[model samples]
Target: MKDRRRFSRVPFKTEVEVLFERRRLAAKNLKDISLKGLYVVAPERPPVGEICQVKVKLTGAEPPVELIFTGEVVRHGPDGFAIVVTETDLESFAHLRKLLSYNLADPEKIEAELGRLIR
Candidate 1:
């Protein structure tokens, strides 16, 4: 069972198509993602603490999100390797959070803004 707080792992597996340092390749069946880091199930394990950029597409969202950040390899397994994202492009992450049912202070804020615009 994965924890649901702090470093909350996503429910479904994802696909991380990566472009790293002039090299373009795709990893299959990404496991989980969180604010702290993401776990990628990859066969070709990069060296531990090696920083690499990754692009992951969340399920049910149009246009795959591009993540240009550094990741360090933490562990390697027979089926895949686990990577810890060192840095993240939070700008995109924030936007995605909004799309994924993020709570707004007031749901009618948008309507209030629109009302002001009309007046």
Candidate 2:
């Protein structure tokens, strides 16, 4: 199948908490995150199209930071589920950029993508 992703994915692995249907699920992640969304592997998967909250714990920040996104479940498969990000707070957005910038080969490319994202 053709990849429809607009943003480049960064290989990131960490513990992520998925909140859906008023229940919080702990996921041991094999995560690949982008500016747009993330892939999460959890035992209990949220249904497609379900609106949920995802909190990705950034393990090594000075104090600590959780990159939180309010997103929709867009796909489900054996690997787990894919969430398409709808919204995030300003701090989370900033941290997300930093994380992606650190991981991706061309930091400026992501910044360029961010500019395109606005329109």
Candidate 3:
């Protein structure tokens, strides 16, 4: 199958809390993340096309802020579900950018992908 990914993903295991509709779901296994989305390993998977809010708390941030991301559920399997990022606040975006930069060997690749997405 042809790969349809826009941005490269990196391992970013962390605590993830998702607000699915009016229900709150928590997962400890956040498999990976890209500039565009998240892959969460959980017991429950929301239906495809459902929009959800994902939050990742930053323990190191001096003021303490969580990276909030709003995205649509694109795929789900027995192990986990995938979300395609649709919205993010400025602060969260900055935090995500920095996290990806720190994890990726070639940080510029993520930036280039962001540029392409913007255009």
Query: Against the true structure, whose lDDT is highest?
Result: 2
Q: Candidate 2's residue-wise lDDT over 1-119, tens digit each?
A: 99966799999999899999999988989479999999998767899999999999988977878999999999997879999999999999999999999999999989988987888
What TM-scores do the predictions have? Answer: 0.62, 0.94, 0.92
Question: Candidate 3: lDDT of 83?
Answer: 95
Clashing pairs in 2: none
Error of 3 at 38 (Å): 0.6
Between candidates 2 and 3, which one is better according to lDDT?
2
Worst 10 residues of 2 by lDDT: 57-66
- RMSD, one per candidate, in order: 9.1, 1.2, 1.3
How well does model 1 score by local distance difference test? 0.59
Q: Can you tell me which runs of candidate 1 are displaced by over 4 Å?
A: 1-6, 19-22, 95-119
Better of 2 and 3 by TM-score: 2
Report lDDT per candidate.
0.59, 0.91, 0.90
* Ranking according to TM-score, highest score first: 2, 3, 1
**Top TM-score hit:** 2
Please provide, for model 3 over 1-118, each residue's C-alpha lDDT reduced to its tens digit, 9 standing for 90 to 100: 9998889899987889999889998998899999998899999988899999999876776887689999999999789999999999998999899999989999999889889878
